[model samples]
Target chain A: MIKVDNISMRFNLGIEKNFSMKQFVVDLFSPSKRKEKKKKKVNNEFWALKNVSFEVKRGEVMGFVGTNGAGKSTLLKIVAGVMKPTEGKVSVGGNICPMIELGAGFDSELTARENVFLNGAVMGYSRDFLQSKYDEIVDFAELADFMEVPVKNFSSGMIARLAFSIATIVEPEILIVDEILSVGDAAFQKKSEAKMRSMISGGTTVLYVSHSAASIKALCDRVVWIDHGHVKMIGDAKDVCNEYLRSLGLPVEGEGNGA
Target chain B: MIKRVWLNFKKYSFLLKQLVARDFKIKYKRSVLGVLWSVLYPVLMMIVMSIVFSNVFKFTTEGVSYLAYLLSGLVMFNYFSEATNLSMSSVVGNFSLLNKIYIPKYIFPLSKCLVTAINFALTLIPLYVVIIIESFSYPDMKLSLLHLVLPYDYICLFMFTLGVGLILSAVTVFVRDMLYIYGIIVLIWTYLTPIMYDITIISNPILQSLMKLNPLYLYINFARQIILHGWMPTPAYFAACGGSALIVLLIGMAVFKMNQDKFIYYV
Candidate 1:
């Protein structure tokens, strides 16, 4: 289970056209110039998330749907324990497996076999567990022959497949995925979706963020639609997603509202 | 705080081992000479320093061969230099991993320091070989069981380097110029310490004490006493080295804890 209470994130954007630490130091010595620069800077405190409160049950699939720059990724990152919110607190029970960025922890110089263990270790998996699951991970990724090849030589699709394989090797209590399902070919996509469905059936609470509304409707039990860092609507997946699409002036499914 | 750190260390010990393994593998991956470079590097430096200082500068090594004395100092100093230098960029170099995962932030620098320590251990094989050969030639120079204290000296040196490394890695995340600045500092620091020359040349007691304040000098001096002269270091010398390491380590941990959360923003 996870509980997020009034979480907010604030970022200070330096407003100077070419702000650097050197210039900041120079401005520090001259109070008069510092005041002038401060007055000129506008809306420096950008709130990426504002009073975003939500909860996830132990075995629920929650989907976060929003356009780009809507704080979906930021909220996911906060839940994954990679970032801290400026305002409120979050309590997460059980270990979380975050598939935030594919191949983010991989070493380009190491072979795929080595990276399997490397990425596994990063996710806090012990070596013995990874060794036992090594065959399954490789068979799932379908890179059996290329296990000895350096990861830098693999194609982007192959890398994504390897990352997904490593992240989902175990049945995590909570899985946080950010735009990972959109990669790779159609066949691999279908296979990964099946794998996610199996994990969901195995009592995994998944918090997923994606721009695709179709996947949200298909996979999520509850949908939270966020716009401009605020929750616009939260409820049943079908209702919330329909309302979200309606707000965007797009056609609702089965409604015959077309251009 | 200590309990929290201990629990975290226990939880992440596996990750730490893998990271150290990765660093070592990457270091010697494509090199033709491989681990031999660790041995050859200090030997080459010892030869060059011996030739220059012994012939040109006419610096005496008290009674022991200048080469043996220089090698002892070079081994410890090189370990300090390499460990600190590698760890200074450990955090910034792994910004990608930092941004994506939620492991303890100090693990990166700590692992880099450990990998360098492993390299130091490998280099010691040749160092001991050189010591044994020198003892055969110089009757006054004999290997003593007291040299067992050398491992303790290394532990002190490792701790000191790790403490400084933590501070440097954390600071470099915000100020990239720290890399260049640290390079210059290490170069000047090498000369300031008694790596190339004997400290006895400085007759002034106050100046000698000032040089002794250098942590590397203490460890290097203690090591030379045990390895080259076959004499046990005084308990005060042990306390000085260990105490300096503990103080620096505490300061480094405090600084790292304060600055770690802010690292995501800076990097």
Candidate 2:
């Protein structure tokens, strides 16, 4: 179970460029820019999320749908605990296995074999557990022949498959997957979708973010439609998805053919 | 409290091992010299510094050969600098991976320290080699059983460096300028510590006492006392080493914990 209450995320547009200490000190001494920032309302900052409250009960597969920069990724990151909400609190009851970005933890300098253990360790897996599951992860990723090769040399899809295999190795209590079902080639994507279905049906509480209307409708029990960092709509998966499609001027599923 | 900390330690032990191995492996990957560089690095540094200091500075060693004093001081101070520098970058270095998942942030800096500690241990072989070779010139420079307790002082230095590293790594996340500023600070700190010259030459009481306050000095002194003087360090020396290490470590842990939650947002 997860509860995200009144969550808001603020990003400072001004400080992103002035990351160095020298620039920060110069900015401190310069009163004009500082005064101008305060005089103008948002202070060169923008909220990525605003008063977003949601709850996911155990064993529910929730989906997030939105266009680019609609704050879907930020919400998923907050739910996964990779990020903390600016003004609100999130309470999670179970261990979170966040696949926010596939293979984000792997060091390209290390071999595929090394990254498997490294990424697994980051997910709080014991060495013995990874050792026992090592062969399985290698086989599932179909990189058994490439395990000894460094990840830097592997193709992007190979890296993604490897990360997907490591993440799905154990059925986590709570899983947050962000648009990762579309990873790899057609066959591998189908395999991963099947893996996700089994995990979802086997009582794992899942919070998934994906742009594909078909996948969300097929998998998510409920869908949250986010638009411009706010909850635009929230309801049954098919309903919210159709509403989302209509907003985009796209054909709604089963609207003309089956209606 | 200690029991809980020990349990936490036990839980992260495997991760710590992997990170340390990751760093240690990466350092020597595809290198012909491999781990030999760790042994050669200190000796090479000592030779260059020894030549310059002995010839130009013309300092008195008090009793043990100049090489003994210089090698010990070099290894200790170098470990502190190298560990803290690497640790400073560890978090900022892994910010991308960090932003993607949840792992204890402190582990990165701590593992960097452990990696450099391995480097320090390897350097000890050459440190002792220099001492043995120099012993032929100065009989008092001979190795003694007291030297076996060097690990005690080494641990103290490791803790102190780890503490400072944690602070710097956390601070670096906010102020990326620390990456450059620390380089200058390390250089200034190297000259400030009595690594090359005899501490007696300071002459001014205030400056001498000020030098004692530098934690690295205490750790280096503890090692030097055991290795060069060939005697057990006084109880006060032992307490000073342990107390300073624990105190800095506590402060570091406090600062790190306080800032760590905010780190994800900033980075």
Candidate 3:
């Protein structure tokens, strides 16, 4: 289970036209010259998240949908514990495996097999466990032949597949995936979704973010619609997804929200 | 707080090993000489300094051979500089990893220090070789059991480098200009630490006391006392070296912890 309690994040965006530390230091000593630049203030404070509160119970696949820059990624990052919330607290129970970005910790100069252990270690897996499960991960990714090849040589799709395979090798208690469902080719996507289904069946709580409403409808038990850094709506997956689509001016397929 | 760090250490030991291993592998990946560069670097530096100081400056090495004296100071100083310099970039260099996952922030700088420590160990082979060669020329030069104290000196040096590294790496994330500024600072620091000259040459008591306050100088003096002079260091010397390490480590940890949470915003 994960709980985000009244969390908010604030960022300071610098507004000066030609701001540099060198110029700032120079301006510090010369007060008369600094007066000209005083018209443009240093920064503008903006809130990326505002008092967003939510809870994900164990064994629930919850989906987060929003437009670009709606703070979907920021919320997931806060939940994953990579970024601390500015105003509130978060409590997470159990091991969390966050696949926020494909191949985030990979060393391109290293081989695929080396990265398997490297990435697995980052996920807090023991060396012996990874060693035992090494072959299984390789078989799942179907990259057995390219295990020795450097990841820099691999295609983006290949890298994505490897990242997905290593992240899901062991069924984590909590899995946080960010728009990774559309990774790799269509066939591999199907395979990855099937793997996720099995993990969900084994009682893994998942927090997933994606732009595809259809996938959210198919997988998530409930959906949280976020807009302008606020929780716009939360309800059954179909209801929330349909409402989200309607807001986007996209046609609502088949039946309405009554269904 | 200590317990949390310890638990994270236990959990991420494998990841730390992988990171250190990756650093070592990447350093010599396409090079033909491979690990030999570790030894050759100090040897070349020793030869260059020996020629300049022994012949041109006519600097007295006291009773020790100039080559041995220079090599000893060069290796330790080089290790300190290399470790801290590499670690200064550790956080900024691993932005991708920091962005996607949450691991203890210290691990990046710590891994950089460990990799340099391994290379420093390799450089010791050439240092010892210089000592043995000098032993044949100077009858008073003999390897003693006191040389074992060199490892203690290395431990102190490691702690000091790691402490400074932690502070610099954390600062570098916010101030990108730190990279260029650190380069100039290291150059000046090398001259300040008396790496190529004997501290005894400075007859001023005030200057000598100030030199004693330098942590690197304390570590170098401890090593020289054991290896060059074949004598045990005074207890006061140990206190200076170890105390500086401890104090700097505490300060570094405090600074790093305060700034780490805001790192994502700046980076």
The all-Cα superposition gives candidate 1 an RMSD in Å to the true structure of 2.0
For model 3, which pairs clash?
A: none
Per-residue lDDT over B36-77 for candidate 2, one digit per residue giving the tens place of the 0 to 100 score: 899888888988998998988787697688888999999999
User: Tens digits of per-residue lDDT for model 1 on B12-44?
Assistant: 888899899888889978899998898889998
The value of fnat for model 1 is: 0.55
> Model 3, chain B: what is the TM-score?
0.96
TM match of model 1 to true structure: 0.96
* Candidate 1 CAPRI level: medium
Q: Relative to the unseen true structure, what is the C-alpha lDDT of residue B25 in candidate 1, on a scale of 0 to 100?
A: 89
Off by over 4 Å in 3: A15-19, A22-43, A256-259
Q: lDDT of each prediction vs. the true structure? A: 0.88, 0.88, 0.88
TM-score of each: 0.96, 0.93, 0.95
Top model by DockQ, which number? 3
- Across A11-69, the per-residue lDDT of candidate 3 in tens digits comes to 76653334477887999999987886664343356788888988999999999999999
Residue A234 error for model 3, in Å? 1.4
Against the hidden true structure, what lDDT does model 2 obtain?
A: 0.88
Question: On DockQ, who's better, 2 or 3?
Answer: 3
